[model samples]
Target: MKTRRVFLQRAGISAVALAMPTLNPLLAMTKSADPLKNYAQTLRVAIMGLGSYGTRVAEAIQSCTRTKLVGVISGTPSKVVEWREKYGIPEKNCYNYENFDAIKDNPDIDAVYVITPNALHKDQVIRVAKAGKHAICEKPMAVNAADGQAMVDACKEAGVHLLIGYRMHFEPNTLEVVRMRKEGELGEIRFFQGLSGFVIGDPTQWRLDPELSGGGAMMDIGIYSINGARYMVGEEPIWVTAQEVKTDPVKFKEGVDETITFQLGFPSGAVASCLSTYNMNYLDRFYLNGSKGWAEMQPSTGYGPIKGTTHKGPLTEPIVTHQTVQMDEMAAIIFDGKEAEVPVNGAEGVKDMKIIDAIFKAIKTGGKVDLTFG
Candidate 1:
């Protein structure tokens, strides 16, 4: 059977090569049909927020054939100046947060990738949507469910695509597991375990501030587990039970949780156990158990180079920058109406936010919190 790759090879052949099968070599050197061609031509993007993650996103985008960074928005004037010079962006393409709304008038920037602090995502995404550009926001998506809904509503009103920075949605190995589950290779999923955490070294970072980051490990790092639970089990949770433990009030602060253990009960009779913390290293992993088989992903939800295995075999997918694949796919999604292998829409993010909210409520009251996504 001729796949798309084979089709591209045949399309590149000379008339003589069409007549011969065994010895034709010219077609082999021809480029496979570039799936990103249309996106590469149409997607002009901007990076909002020039922080560490923003810088890395910008750099990763340079490798994306489907997207180009044409503008920048930053609160820090010095960083804006440096970025404009570095990317060769015209003066008209630069903006500060206060003046960013004027971007609605610019035609060059087709999308805005928001990489600001957690609390700022709601307002910033609203503004970006109003500016008539597609909104690609960093994860947790917002400080809480309410803010996530506001962002979603704003984008819906503006008729713009709202994509959260769930890079694993585009990751090859991770998506393979999702494929396996959908294919029934995992049979009926009965149990799942999601673990995500890190020893956040800087006590002064924004992640520790409840107002800025929304919550402690649960907000900043635990979301990986939350999302993993949903995707691995392939069902929306019906209820949540949680417990919180904190050892350092100085570092984690009041109104913030240092560590949390939560359980999610799915409608399919599958249950997930999750652990989230701010005092562990290389702590991202997932285990899904099913009637016929099981899958395990260690170093699963981290930034890159994921390693894992399943009942069938080991994950042999090559390592690539999660951000690189994400940006390219985002470009295609906005410009060509391309759907993600797994949805990364704002609605999907809001569902996770609702689960997080339930988890927090469960911890506060020491009771099971019911959840329903309709």
Candidate 2:
């Protein structure tokens, strides 16, 4: 087994407050939050989805030193029973989907982890924010950019933090890539290629439903490429153009895309080509070409054991549970207000959603779509 280091414990102040003596000025401001009176207390969390990803998140939280899964929101009573038995949660900590808003009065859960389907994210996040709890929503943030904006506004107005689950932002290898890029290791990056996809097995799965998933592979799996494009270049995209193809209309209904190949032009003159699809297998990879040398990550965006190499050499870091580290950092940010190396808040997520929206539009119009983010 590889040795792992948890960065959250080294934070000087309560994770909610980033004004430690060692923090840089820029970091202090972005991570600033009121110091919790109970800085040493455990931050309680509610797992809203009992699906595969939600189950995995619950398991990962068990290893967290500063967070606890104290509540749940599930549509299935059987899952509630199983979770209560597995996690030692009481019945009061369990809630059905319809009555979950009453969690405001429970006082046990400090935050709600919205891990449900893509379309359900908006309403659930709003309810969590309205209930005066912080929200940590899964990626794509919402079905559309407008809904994404609404979730951000709701959380900001409620004075609760809104975090998106971009686990790679906190992963060691991924961070190393960001650091190397910033340090000029790749030397003036000019082009990038991001490939993210997986073969869909079940035709009847929610991921195929336009209403439930918002879109097909682009919404479900292609987001990795969208996010990869921005972080790899360290700049926002300014324009986009794309094309979509669907060989099976029965499996991929109207409003659901099967595969999309898109290009992004950044303000810094960097251009990126990306592919997102559900018909391919083991396709997660990212490559960057710069004036001097290049960097590439194979199995870049998959769930763990990420591998990468640059012109200098391959990544030497060992693989760790990305979710475990992510949850720990989120706890520090939520309760102690610690600043992440990069922002993982709703704003960051909205920027990516904006790009995804533009990609779809560009595909539909067969013309370039310009984008701007504030």
Candidate 3:
């Protein structure tokens, strides 16, 4: 799959000189006093489109101490010789997808996660930020919001870091119910419901291809009820309204999508009632309400022991491995500039792709729509 003359022969130039712009030596290194002991002596990651959630993020980055899955970029050469003998890797840090921008001359790889197919995540995260590395991707980061803000302006004009898998922002009982609804204990908040779906089963995969899943089950499981109703109604929703219910229009063709129900409105007059489906089954749940009390989670965005309750009680919290604590808290928010209580960058994935473009423009203008995220 990788042949543009093996990416212009080891990227020896021109794809506009491997996308010009540069200068980001790990964002000029510095801040340390034990940046997790210098990011456990170097982060070193790599995996771009190996599929099955990139083998569950390379087995949860082997339970990441700091995060070190050496390298890989497969376009299937026997799945890159079966993940280079199951992750021993090396062979110039193995890559395909056309030489993967010569991994910018490989210094044993620093980052490049992308996991592919959400319309190829804005050109593989702008070619992993024009190959200067650091890019994480995944989630519904693109296929909208102008290709997720052109992959966050090509990783901020190539200074790097783009992150956005949003692994429930490092789940621990969903950040303890987003830190008990920001310590007010769900008090003045108003509403939220987010019931994400399931029940999809290969109607010819590539997620039922709307040109590789730009939409279907609301861009795959209704973007976990639109990013769990903006982190359980903490805010940011201006407006949106929608409805769609394709009972298999020949396997949800015409730009995909199947079963969607949305609403959002927030601005302290908070509101959200969502559902996204692919012919549901045990739909995951998340609920929040308040003027005084409420919170709930039932298999909420599963991929662990997430179960909950609130109005004070039963959250439990110690169930780890949501992609191994999101690659060890994204190696301390990319080498210790640390700051993700909830945001998972690329402008929090362009505010959930501008609320999935105002819920597909309020499902084609049946009304509501207005939204504005800064």
Candidate 4:
């Protein structure tokens, strides 16, 4: 196995291809055309963390006919001021961590997308919910299942929608594969393999910190494999067994996993083998084999034109930028009552977290851990 020295842990920013800039169909919206007249409704969003992924999403939202970036919530004054000048956000629409609660009174902002560190997601999303603004948070959703559930419950009580950032759930090629499986084109699913990882670069980065990151590679890139297995196999895992590997403990540190190999058994008798790591390269792949046919995506979960092939032929779905389609689809889901081909709601997020909790337990016990989802 090849090990790398650095990782792009930023959300929706790195995967495989510039990490390929996902190829997406450009919307009808243009600077010359008015979006209000073209689209039925619009979702005005404020991003909480001004990180690389947040900037990427903000850039994509510029082209969305139904989604608009109208505000920002950041702890750094420089980033806030930078976003204001660059995105043309108004002074009144700006907010910091301590004052974002005032958004409840500001009707102009429709939602807040929490892109903060892993451990911060629960509190930030709950606060966004309590403020009556819809909350869209980047995954895992939280550090653990309990925190994930708390965010979900808080949003439910606040009567606001809670959306987890599952960009691949809206990807064209991924959905094409899903459609094939759902329509019985893939036959009885039997196996799945997902490999996701990259090297860790800066040991001092927040991602390497136990408090902010909650964990290591598994908490970051590993999620792609876990989520992919469930969707590709069309079943949630009933049991999981995992083993951990650590190299250069000085960098990985305590509570931070270096690499992990895991197995998942589903109710349908299908099984999946997956690997998540922060110490390897040339990973990013997803494969599924069923009784009748099979599908494979090499650069599966990356940021591009996702490339894939199956027993039938190559997957040639219309390529759309990952973040662009995600934001547009999210707007439709929030405003037009449209359901996604794949779930991206809070419950979906919690299920992943529960499975992750089980994986960690299995690692500690060196035995299979059974999983049950509600």
Using lDDT as the measure, the top candidate is 4
List clashing residue pairs in candidate 2: 14-336, 15-336, 15-337, 15-338, 16-335, 16-336, 16-337, 17-336, 17-337
Error of 2 at 15 (Å): 12
**How many times do residue backbones clash in model 1?**
0
lDDT of 3: 0.79
Reference-based lDDT, residue 88, model 1: 87
lDDT tens digits, residue span 1-374, model 2: 01112223432234444443322221211212332222365668999999999999998777665567999999999999999999999899899989999998988888999999999999999999898888999998998899999999998787778999999888778888888889998889899999988889899999899899989999978898888888989998999999998898898889888999999999989999999998888789999988887889998988878999988899877676777778767876765556787779999989988988898888878999999999
TM-score of 4: 0.92
What lDDT score is found at residue 108 in candidate 2? 86
Task: Score every model by TM-score.
Answer: 0.89, 0.90, 0.34, 0.92
Q: By lDDT, is 2 or 3 better?
A: 2
Q: RMSD per prediction, one decimal?
A: 7.6, 7.0, 18.1, 9.6
The CA root-mean-square deviation of candidate 1, after full C-alpha superposition on the true structure, stands at 7.6
lDDT of each: 0.83, 0.84, 0.79, 0.87
- The 10 consecutive residues of candidate 4 with the worst lDDT sum are 1-10
- What is the Å distance of residue 13 in model 1 from its true position? 30
Off by over 4 Å in 1: 1-41
What's the distance in Å from true for residue 68, model 2?
A: 1.0
The alpha-carbon deviation from the true structure for residue 226 of candidate 3, after best TM-score superposition, in angstroms, is 4.9
Better of 1 and 2 by lDDT: 2
